[model samples]
Target: MNVLLLLLILSFASTIQCDIHTNRIEDTLSTEANDTNTLCKDHLQVPEKVRIDLYYESLCPYCKQFYVKELAPVVQKLMNYIELYTYPFGHAQMKKNDNKTTFECQHGPTECYGNGLHACAIQYLPKMSEYVPFNTCLMEKWSTDKDAEQCGQRLHLNAEPIRTCANSDEAINLVIYYAQETEKLKNMSYVPYTVINHKVMDPETDLIDSVCATFEKPPQECKK
Candidate 1:
């Protein structure tokens, strides 16, 4: 009778241990599932970058007007929320002659020269804070002097580097690069063409509206 009682007690203890092991595995799996859910929720909350690509030339009168009137304000307001990339070759094609590359513009030779200066500004100075004002000032004064040396002087930007870059190999390549970019857009029909988040914006509509519409999480100012 004593031996039988000892065997029964041992069996009961083993059953209890088995139950505890099973409960531990269930608890571990539940914790792991909860952790995965939390990670997925956090990842989904992160915001995506908004892209704005502007293709324009310096001396194109319509492009200049749009820059001054339409784009500047929206760029100033949504600077943080959007990524802006400006390409200064509009409806222009590049060709090689006498071991040097030359670009032809829609407007004229003067427009071509002005566009070169703008490319120089972009190359020599990458900062938008300085480059935007310089571009605006140059556009305002473009009719008087297509070379834009005087505009550089007026804007307090150094003119010599810009003049040097106008005819340099780097500037030529940059303009060519921009021209290639313009060519990639299937619906590109004219200067001042704007693309927002890889989609070509409507020609009849203003791009500022698209900028506000495309943000994944619009800022409070945008809501206003």
Candidate 2:
């Protein structure tokens, strides 16, 4: 009886181990096989150490427009010389839409509800780090049409985690840290401020002109 019990326990443990191993292999294979590209408006040809930090809230229509109309084109032209980063502000606390108390669709272009989708985006950053083109697509969808479900599905993201993060103090503070630290390091006094090669640029002129001049390969670039 004792021998039988021991044998049964060993068998169960072995089965569990096998199952775990199989699942892990499947996960790895799935991830490895995924080769999707992310689409961003600004596809900067970034050189190492030349980083750009853009601060804006997801709900801010102005930010969305700037990204689509200006930043995306500039980045695409200067892809070899610019590295882009994001800082989200304003709707950090997941304020619900006035009409939809449970979850509000605040803007037409973005697919967010001031809820978990935002948090989920941050949480899943690890899985998404490699997919640059998708980030652009997600942002583009959110900017033009506020369909959180469609946007999430478009990016292959889960909604639950994003909502959870939007309400989380830790997540808020983390985003805050990124914004504040960026401001401090780059001596930024405003949002949409671009730091290029240690110079603080006005979002309107300096940043735009700098990117253009770099692509134009002008020996003497205009300083805005």
Candidate 3:
């Protein structure tokens, strides 16, 4: 009877040990699962965007080429990783005579008008997504009130406000604001002056490569 009782006790002890082992395995698996979830959350966090500034004149052929051929083609891909700012005053002189402010553009009066149109568009369409396409259309075709209206209609944006702004003092002030921003760069001598992350980018360098270099964790578009 003692031997049988001893076997039964041993079996019971074994069952208890199995239960403990199972509980430990379940607890360990739960901890590992929680840790995995935490890791995934960290991995999925959004990263900061790189900043890009383009300082160019509206009538500059090089600016138009850059905007139409180079930047516009890949802008959508980079939008996920970049914050773009465009300054429409380049080599444009603002003079104050007897409290009257006058401006002169390198190209001509037409260039000044083009710059004003761009400034007004930027003022009305604060978002890059909205203004970039409009400006791209302007640069590709021409920078005129008619062109602005056509681009606005193509983009399904209201052109009246932008046209009114362009003809008013608001556009002039916006150009002045951009002039102030552009003057911040000392020894600036050319159109299509590009800055990435507050640093001047060499004109020879590929824009996409320069932009991709700024990211810590580049987006999928950068991989291409």
> Best lDDT goes to which candidate?
3
Report lDDT (CA) for all predictions: 0.72, 0.47, 0.82
Candidates sorted by TM-score, best first? 3, 1, 2
Per-residue lDDT for 61-162 in model 3, tens only? Answer: 999999887777657778766768899999999998998777999899999989999999888898878888899999987799999999988999998898
For TM-score, the strongest prediction is 3
Model 2 C-alpha lDDT per residue in residues 1-224, reported as the tens digit of each score: 99999999997886665555444432443432222101111222212223465655555566656656676665655555455665554333233366422322334324233323343355556442322333444456552224444655775755445445655664544554544554455344444555564456666674567655543343222232
Those runs of model 1 whose alpha carbons end farther than 4 Å from true positions after fitting are: 1-48, 143-155
Model 3, runs deviating above 4 Å? 1-44
lDDT of 3 at 159: 81
Arranged by lDDT, best first = 3, 1, 2
- Candidate 1, which ten residues in sequence have the lowest lDDT sum? 40-49
lDDT: the better of candidates 2 and 3: 3
TM-scores for all candidates?
Answer: 0.71, 0.47, 0.79
Better of 2 and 3 by TM-score: 3
Candidate 1, lDDT over the whole model: 0.72
